[model samples]
Target: MDVLCESAPNDDDCGTRYSSSSSEDDERRDQGVAMTYMTLDSILNDNSRMFEFLRSFGVLANKYVCATCRKPMSCVKVATTRCGDGLMWRCAKDKVWRSVRKGTWFEKSKIKLKSIVLLTYCFCMRKSVQSTCRITGLSDKTVVDWFLSCREICSALMKKRGKIGGPGVVVEFGESSFGSNKYDKGRWMAEVWVWGAVVCGKDHGELVLNVVEKRDARTLQWFIEEHVENGTVIYSDKWDSYEDAEEFDLQSFAADHNYQFRNKVTGTMERYWKEVKRVLEGGKRRRSGLQSHLDEYIWRESVFVHGCAFHSFMQSVGALYVPRVED
Candidate 1:
């Protein structure tokens, strides 16, 4: 929640892009599958458009009920204002004033709505904080905090998506250590071990990557039980900790790394481990923030693999911030 959105500067720069029906189609491919791609330049150049974009998706509140009036408020533009967009929620009945962003995800933000959208886009693209700062004119701290918020969003999404693989599903899993004594700001850091798994034989399988204190049976079993469903076909290396996998009613298979990384009968987790290591190694953060990066990596693989990264992420923003009506 360390959001640092700076207020938008151009108060009168509202555009009519939101009025166009075709604007929502930007994140789609001709084949109907989502392929969210929007340029930073395109987002940075507009303030009102981003507000409208978020409004279209309900990330920003569409309407408000006045506390005093107890009726719906109209979004009216003030003649002179500096709080990002010029609009505010106004109730004609009681002369009560409210922010259009009130009670929404953007309520506490100090930056333009467009910048928030741009930040999510940058996160989706895996852009560095420095480069994102240059592109979005956001401070490093702001970018870092927003990126962390994005990671938190990823973690929440993962929990909501629930565990991966089920009965009759093949799951590939492994354990690996991440650390570098060679150079981490010229100091040695502790090794961080992570247990990772994926739905095998699929380009975009369900995933689970968790940082563990140790790789013992009790420790690994805790995460394994949490992240994976029972009755899954679990493939792994010959790690003794997984001896009790069947105790949880799981179907377990082991590969002997001494002979080969993979064999027709046993090994399937080699490629999955390679992908996880590749992502973890690509990060520039310290061991402390490794879990965030790993969570974000798993989230991206879960979402972006469907070719709907930015769009899907924005929808998640809407779902989280928008109040739902109970049936």
Candidate 2:
């Protein structure tokens, strides 16, 4: 909710890149099984192109209805103004004026729309913060803040959607620890435990990454019951905590890493941890924001099967901001 910039800059200085036919190209490029880097020219040619694209996906609303009078409002700004760049609207009933970005993620945001959109693309792409900062010409703090916000939206949506694996599905379960032993003897020592699972698919799969307090049987059981579906084939290493998984109506299988009959599903999750740590640069000083990093990793993994990760994420933004019963 906080704007990470000192002041919002004009469109030309925002470093937004786009091509005239880039939207069509995006549609075509996104059809691949793996996500590829989009050229800046292929991303957005003009400022309004991104706005129009969001609208086409129903991420942005068709009408700007007034909140005060509940009537469809008409634009009060000049025809040439960007829709999201502080354009004004006039209520049909009360004749009151309102800023277009009054209540959305763009509200109180001091970053350009194009930069925001590009930052989102970079996040979905799982690019490093330093890399994204260089590309967008944004401060490291600003880009990190924006990436965390997007992760918040992804986390909220994942929670709303509930558990992943179901009947006949193999859900790999694992517990891992992060942080170095050099700090272990000092007051700065931090032991971070992360419990995670993956619903393995042939090409791409969904994952659940949770930061838990303890790695005990009680804790693991509670996490599994809360986040995994009933009758799922839960696979894991021979950890003592997972020994009682069958007590919870799940098909539990345990194996040792040295054994030939190791579970492939759990293997994938191990590789995932490597990729996650690699992207976060070993996640050394990010103890406080570990969950956000996990959320970003999970969300990025979920999008590999789909062509347009950015568009899918944009569609999620509307529901992410909507007031939910749980919230």
Candidate 3:
């Protein structure tokens, strides 16, 4: 029996010996051994490799520390099964011993890391959660939970870096209303007004969306002050609420539709508003959780502008090393 180092090349590295009896069986066994070695190598080299490596060793490798308890984990094997796609490894830890578990923003989730990566890619590409579930072959509940977990991560990222658009940034601001039930006599149906601003640049400015109680001067000014810096150039349509721009020191300019404003120069903000509204209304569920949902919408828009894939963004987010207490 040849013992191969974990990093060594597969069975092909070893010289073959012919056994007169069952030569075919010997060849098949060698092939199987080679394939298994290759799979292990691939897993070890996987960029997204998380806890599985530690679990395979039967001791948490000190790196896969519990995010909550800050202690190394011990793999408590639960069950093993093979799905149509591949093998499944399920493990459990004491609630106290666990922290944010693999594949979750919280501790101790059973979802696979690969599934999370796939779902994140789908999300960054603007695929609906239902569509993502279909693509990943996950249940609706699982997909939704993953999405919410990702949203929490995204929110933490956004909070750490305050106000994306900064000094010398030129921003275009706009507002749109959805879920208005004027025809239904406006009983319990009130209009959900979304105020959006996109910085104007070679690409669209990182988008900011806020759900405003009303699109009044106070609200608009608040949005501008919160997201944009003073002395920034702001362009918008002629709205009375924007009249008090002098107080904010914002170089406010009104777009002239009669002049056929080009999208490259003047209509960038409007374009973002259109895109966000389209995405918000894309699903049949009609997002009723207004505030947090709008935050997520803005997050998606910003991600689109930054051209970040979901997993990459998540890794970059982790690099920020923000304290979990703030989250």
Candidate 4:
């Protein structure tokens, strides 16, 4: 049973291709196991191996302490299955027993660890909700909730990534609206504004995206100060909202969008805005969850540029979500 330790991949590792590209990925998964995006049935018959595989990835604890007995728990192969996996954590003296999933990320989830893993892969691949439901045999509500849970994890990580666009970095600002049209009259029943700033270059740089209540001067300047570093070379359309950009130590350039949509100077940010808005429009997420989805988008966008999307995301999950055996 070999674990995948591929690091710093290239074109093949981006998005779902990392796990679904070839049989080598499945062989590296564990044993003669064949794990892919569409199906995980090959790994189902061996629960004990599945348990150890997850343990190797920090998804489960390799060593556990019994909370009730205050003693060490040993992984023992059991004959019967009550914990869904035929493995149990047994304590020596008091005969205290705990499920293998106790105090792990999969602790409260009724779904199996394998399924959760696949769900995460699908989510990273940007698979649709219906697609995930079909692949994982999970209810629609369960899939939606899990999708949000994944985004919350991304949002937490994004908050820790610090600010984007430092001195000498080319940063661009933009805004777009998304909402339901009223009675097919092309009138927005509700208006939601998405504000974003992206670092521009041939190499993919960082991004800052959020839902803002207003796009006034105070609002735009505030977002720039909060998310972008001082002395960044920034560009945007000639909007009154950004009239005071130079007041904050930023060198600002404004393109006239009426005559020219994307001048060569502002091309990168214009393309980024379209890509983001396209994905956001494709989904049917509620208005309240838009911020989290935006967080997910920016996180994925940045990571996708580096390749190894799924592996990196799983590493983040292990780092951010620590298990509590004492509880």
Report lDDT per candidate: 0.64, 0.62, 0.49, 0.65
lDDT (Cα, tens digit) per residue for candidate 4, span 23-134: 4463234222233543344443445455655665676676778777787676665545555565667776778877777777677888766678778877877778999899
Which is the better candidate, 3 or 4, if ranked by lDDT?
A: 4
Residue-level lDDT of model 2, residues 1-327, one tens digit each, is: 011111342333232222333344453354322333454434444334444454454444445666676666653432334444533455647766655455666666888666887788787766678999988899999998998888888777777767877766787877777775444336453778888888766456778888888776668667777787766777776454345644532233212211121244548778777877787667554477888778766776676666667768877886565311110
Candidate 3 lDDT by residue in tens digits, 40-144: 334433322333432222222223445455554443322124221122222125353222233324224566544655665555555677788787899988888
- TM-score quality measure for candidate 1: 0.77
Q: Clash pairs of candidate 2? A: 18-44, 18-45, 19-45
Q: Please identify which of the two predictions, 1 or 4, would achieve the higher lDDT against the true structure.
A: 4
Identify the leading candidate in terms of lDDT.
4
**Distance from true location, Cα of 62 in model 3, Å:** 5.4
Question: What is candidate 4's local distance difference test score?
Answer: 0.65
lDDT of 4 at 291: 85
Better of 2 and 3 by TM-score: 2
Give me candidate 2's TM-score against the actual structure. Answer: 0.71
Q: Which stretches of candidate 1 lie over 4 Å from their true place?
A: 1-48, 79-82, 241-268, 282-284, 323-327
TM-score of each: 0.77, 0.71, 0.57, 0.76
Worst 10 residues of 3 by lDDT: 253-262
What tens-digit string does per-residue lDDT give for candidate 1 at 1-327?
A: 011122433445454344322333632432232423444345444545655666767776766777775677766655335455556666677887776677778778887666777787777767789988987899999999999999988877877878877776777777767774455557766677777878877766677877888676667657766777766666665444445644532233222211112212234456656766676563334777888778887777676546557667878888876742111
Error of 2 at 155 (Å): 1.3
Q: Can you rank all candidates by TM-score, best first?
A: 1, 4, 2, 3
